[model samples]
Target: MECLTVKQVADIKGCSQQYIRKIIGQGKITAIEAEEPINHRIQYLIPVETLPEDLRQKYYASIATDGPPVPKEKAVKKEKAKAKKPFEAYTKKEREEIMQWCEILEIWQKKRNHFESKVEGDRNVVGYLKCEYPDKQISVDILYRKYAAYKAGDFGGLLDGRGGWNRGKSAVPEVLFLQFLYFYLDDRQPAVSVCYRATVDAAKELYPEMVAQFPSEQSFRRKLKKEVPEAVVRYMRLGEKECFDKAAPYIERWYDDTEANDVWIADNHTWDVMVMRDDGSEVVHRMYLTAFLDAKSGVLTGWNVTDNPCSDSTIFALRHGILRHGIPKVCYFDNGTEFLTYDIAGRGHRTRKSQRDVPKPETILAKLGIEMKNAIVRNAKAKPIERTFSTLKEHISKLMTGYCGGKPSERPESLKRQLKNGSIPVDSEFREIIDTLIEGQYNQEPYGGTEKAYQGMTRLEVWNESIQNTIQRIASEDDLNLMLMRTTRYQKVKRNGVCIEIAGEKLWYSNADTWQHVGDEVYVRYDPTDLKTVRVYDVEDRFLYTCQVEPALLLNFIEDDKAALADANEIVRSRKKAIRNYAKGITDRLPAEYKIDMLDLSIRKAKLAREGVNIAQSSVIEPIRIDPVKETDHLQELPMASGADNVVSIDIERMNARAEMRKRNKRR
Candidate 1:
C-alpha cells in the first residue's frame, strides 16, 4: 500500500511537520512507524489507504495543485543509495575501459552489414574479432549481451550489479544494533573490541534470545562504520570543539558595511615575555595586556599593559580607546569578572545594599550610548580579540628574550633554566618594542581579513581611511583622569583628613573644605597608581573637592612612596611573624606522647588576647536604658501585702542603697 510521509501530509494539510505530528499525537490522524529513519530521527508514515476520505481527497487535490510530497520510504532508499556513489563501484581504469568498449560496440553495430559481407566471403570472423579487441577477452554471445545492456541503459548498465555484488547480509537485528551503538558511541571512547565483547556479554546477560543474531566482531565493526556517521564518532571522542571544527557548517559573519569604532571586541592576554619593573629591580613579572580591536577595520583601537588583568586594567584600556578613538557603538567581550564592572559593562544585578554607592563601570559606557554584549562562554571563535592575541603570542612574543610558551606542552626542554638565568627586559624597553612591533610591522602589513575596499591596504591604512567618516570624540585630560580612576571609598571627613586604608597602607587625603563636613561621609575616587591626589565627591555624586595627600605622607613619585611605606609595613609584619613563631615554638615544646586539647589554658589565653579580651577581669557596671524619673508614668504603686488594702509607693533612693549593699555582699 502507498504511504505518505509526515512532511507530505503536512504539505497537503498546509501545516508544519510538527503540526502534523501533533495531529497524529491527538489521534486525529493515524500514523505507522516508518521502516527506516530520516537523518537518524525516527519518522512516521501515514498510509494512503487508511486515511479518511475527506483527507484523502484533500491530499489528491494538493497533488493536482502543487506536486505530491515525496514518500519517506522512497526518500530513505534514495538517501541510502546516494551514501555510496555509483562511480565508486568501478575503478577509474575500469570505467574508462568500459566506455571504450561501448564506443567499439556502437561502431561494430553501425557497420554490421559490411562485417557480415566480409564474413560471408569466408574471411576469418573470429580472427577479425580477436584482432579488433586484442586487450579484452570477449565472445560473440557476450559481446551481444553487453551491446544490448549498453543500448538499454548506457554506461550505468555496465556498473549495474557492481554495487551489490557479493554483499553479505548481517545477521544482527536492528534492536541489538541499537543496544550495541549505545555502548560504542559513549563519550568515554571505549575500544571497539571492548565495546563488541561488552555488547555481546550484555546481550547474553539481558536478552538471551538476541545473542544468536549478534554478528562477529569484524562484521559488527564494518556495519558500525557504515551505519554511524563520522560526525557521531568525532562528537563521541573529541567533544563539541572537534565536532564544530570538523562536522559543523561554518556560518560567515560580515561586518564590511559597519563603520570604524561601531563595534569593538576586547579580551585580556598575558604576554609571554618576562618584563622587569620600572624601578629596574631584579625581580621579573608577567605583563597582562587588555586590548580592544575594532570589528570593522581590524585595528588595535586601544590597549593597556599592567601586572595583572583586573577591573582597573580593563577599565583603563576601555578609557584609553574611548578617549582616543571615540566611543564604540557596541562593546563585545567575554563574561570575565573584570568585565562585570558597571563602569564598562554596566551594573548587572544589585547584590548588595546601597550605602554611599559608587557608579558602576557600565555607567560610563551607558552615558556614551554604547551597548555591552558578552560573548558565549567556551566559544572562543565568537571573539575576534582571541585571534588577535593568538597572532601576537605566536609571531611577536616568540621573538623576544625570556619568552615563555603559553602552554606547558609547547615549552622547550631548556626553558626552565633559561628563564631563571635570562636577562629580562625592563618595562620601558618592552613597551617600546611592543609599540614598534604593532605600529611599524603588524598594522602596516597587508591584512587579508579586511573588507573588499581595504583588500590591498594595511590594517592601519584601512583604519585611517575609515575613521575619517567618524565624528571625533576626544576626551579632555581632566575627563580622562576622572574616568580612569579605579579605587572608590566611602569615608567620613575627619578633623585631620579622610583616612583611607588600602593594601594595609593608610593614606590621609585632606582639603581645607573637608573640615566643614567633618562628620559627613564623602565618596573618594582615586587611581591606585597615583595616591597623592583623590577626587572627593558628595553623597549626591557631585564633585566636592580634589583632596591632595597629606604633605608628610606624599612623596615626589609613587614608587618612592611605596618603598618608604613598604619598610613601615615590614615592621608590623615582623611583629605578627614573631608572634606566630613563638606560638609554634611553644606548641613544639610538648612531648611526643602529649596530646593537649586546643581549649587548654595557653591556647585559650592566646584566643582571648587575639579577640582583644582580658578574661581575668570582669565588669560590674552594665548601663540600664531607663531612669526612675522618666518611667514614673508607666510605674504603678502596688500593695505591699495581699491582706493590706493600703498601697505602698516604691522608695527609689532606699531601694538603690539596698541593691548596692546586696551587690557588695555577693562580691564579698
Candidate 2:
C-alpha cells in the first residue's frame, strides 16, 4: 500500500492538514509515523487504503499511472469528486430557503450544546426549527445530514441540486435537432411545426435508429429559442441585407455642424401619380423627379421633372440648385448610373473596376469645386434625400389627379378607370403642381424641431438666415450653362464640319477654325435646350473653338428663282473668298527669296544627278549672297560673294521656262 503525507490527504479531502492531524489523533483515520523527521517534527503518513471509500478511490486514480507512484515533490494535487456551485447560480427563493435552513441549523447547534442530554436537545431543536419554518417539515435525520453536508462544503452544500441537472439540456437527439435547424434556418424560413415535421421525416429516412428518440415539436422550439441568438436566426433566415438593416450598428448624421449649402444630397424618385404626355397623345407615362436637398436646412434647393431619369435631367437639376442656392462644398450621390455618369461625377470614383489608360474628363461637380461622395450601394438609409422623397410622395403625389400607389399591391383599384377616362393631368400641369407643392408648401412648412438651430423656423427661413452669414460662391448663368453642358463621345470633323445627332436629327456645326481641324476627333459640349452652337475641345479637353450650325443649301440648282439663286451664289462666293483669304494670309507670310532658294536647291540636286554626281558626296548647298545695302538703294542689283565664281547659280525664269517646256513635251 502506498502511503500519503498528511497534506496530500487533506488536499484530496478538500480540508486542512490540521483537521487531518486532529482526526488522526482521535483515531478516526489510520496513520503511521515516519522513521525520519520532516522540518524537525514527527512526520505522519496516511495509508491510501485508510482514506474513506470515495477519497481512497480518488487517491488511487490520481496515482494509477503505469510508472511507479509519483514522488512526493512531484505529487499531483487531487481534485474534489464533486464541483461546488457558485452562490449566484441559486434563485432568489432558493437562496432564501437556504438561509432559513442555515439559521435553524445554527440554533439547533446552540441548543444541543446547551443541554446535557443530546436526545432531549435534538427533540426540542426539531420542534423549534419546525415551528420557525412552518411551511417545511423537519426531522432529526434530515437535520443531521444537512448539518454534516454544511460542515463539509459550507453554504454551497445546502443548494437543492434536484431537477437542475437538465436545466438547459434538450430531450431531442443531436442528429434530429441539427436536422430541424437545417429546415428552419433557411432563406425561406419555414414554421417551427413544419421544420419539426420535416426533421422527423428526415430522421426516419436517414437516421432510422434515432427516430424513436426524437422529442416533440414544442421541445425543439424551446431549444431553438433558448440556444440560438436572435441575430443569428435573422441572419440565417432573412439574408444579409435584411439582417444588417435590423441588427447592424449605424452612425447617425448630425446636421447641426453643417451650414446651408455646405452639403447637398441628390437622388431620383418616380412619382406615385401618373400623368399624360403633353403632345396631345392619349398615352400616359410616369414622371421621375431628380432633386437636390440641402442636408442642413432640409430645403429642396433644385429639381427637374422628366419622363425618365437620365444624366441630362441630373445635370439640369444640379445646375438649378447651384444657381439658386450658390455652390455647395460637397454633393452626396446615390450609386445610380444617372447620378454616377462620367460627365457628372467622373469614372472610377465609386465603382470597383476601372479602365486602364482611359482619360477621365473633368465632371460638372469637379468643375464647380464640389467634392462628390457616394453612399453605400443598396443602402437607402444612408441618404437623407430618400426621406425627402418619401415626404414628397405623401404630400405631393397622393394629392394629384391620377393617384397611383407606389407599389403594385398598394395601387388603387380605380386607376384603370381613371386612365381610360383621361383623368390624369398633362405633363405641364403636373410639373406646375410639383413646383407649387415643393416651393410653396414643402419648403415653407415649419421644421418639426429636428435640429436645434431650426427648431422654430421653416426650411426657407433657416436657409435664408444661414445664408446671411455664409459667403455664397454664386455662379453666373453663362458660367453655369457652360459647366453643366452635356458632352458627346469623340466626333470626327468632316468637310461640312463636326456633326452631332440631336433629337434624331444630324446637325452640322462649323467655324472658320474648324476648316483647319478637318479629320481630327474632338469632344463637343452643348446644351440640349439650345442646338444653335456647340463648344469644341481637343482630345485632351483643351477648349478649341465654338462652332455654329452650318446652313443647309438648296438641293435643286435649276429652280428659276433669281433671288434664291443669287443668295445661294453669294453664300458660295463668301465661302470661296474666305478660303482664298485664308490661303493668301498663309502665303503672304513667306518671302520671295525663301521660295526662290527652295526651288534653286531642288534644281541643283536634279542637275547633279543627271551628271552622275552623288549629292551626298557634294558640299552642303549655299544660297547666293545679296548685298542688303545695295539691294535697298537700287531696284535691280546682283552682287556675288568671294567664292561665287566657282559655284554656278541658276536663274528662276530659266527654270520656269524649262518646267513649262517639259510639261508641253509630255502633252504632245
1-668, model 2: which lDDT tens digit per residue? 78989888877777787668767766788999886554665678888777889888767666675333354575778986776666677789878878887887898898899899999989988898788888776899888878997787656666555577887788987767788898999999889999888988886666643554568888998989988888889999999878888898888877666788988999999999888888979887899999999887889999999997988898889888888889999898888888877677764455446454556556778888999888887889989888888888888888877888887897888889999988889999999989888989999988753677578899899999887777799899988888888777677887777877755767888876666788998888889788889999988889988999865443365677777777757766777788778877776687755544445577778888899954564478768998998787778666887787796787877877687667546533
- Predicted structure with the largest TM-score when compared to the true one: 2
Provide the RMSD of all predictions against the true structure, rounded to 1 decimal: 23.3, 17.1
Residue pairs in collision within model 2: none
Q: Identify the runs in model 2 with alpha carbons over 4 angstroms from their true place.
A: 1-165, 209-213, 254-256, 349-361, 444-470, 488-492, 500-506, 519-523, 537-545, 551-577, 584-601, 604-668
- Give the per-residue lDDT digits (tens) of candidate 1, residues 224-305: 8888899988898779789878999976788767778888998899998777788867787788888899887777888887
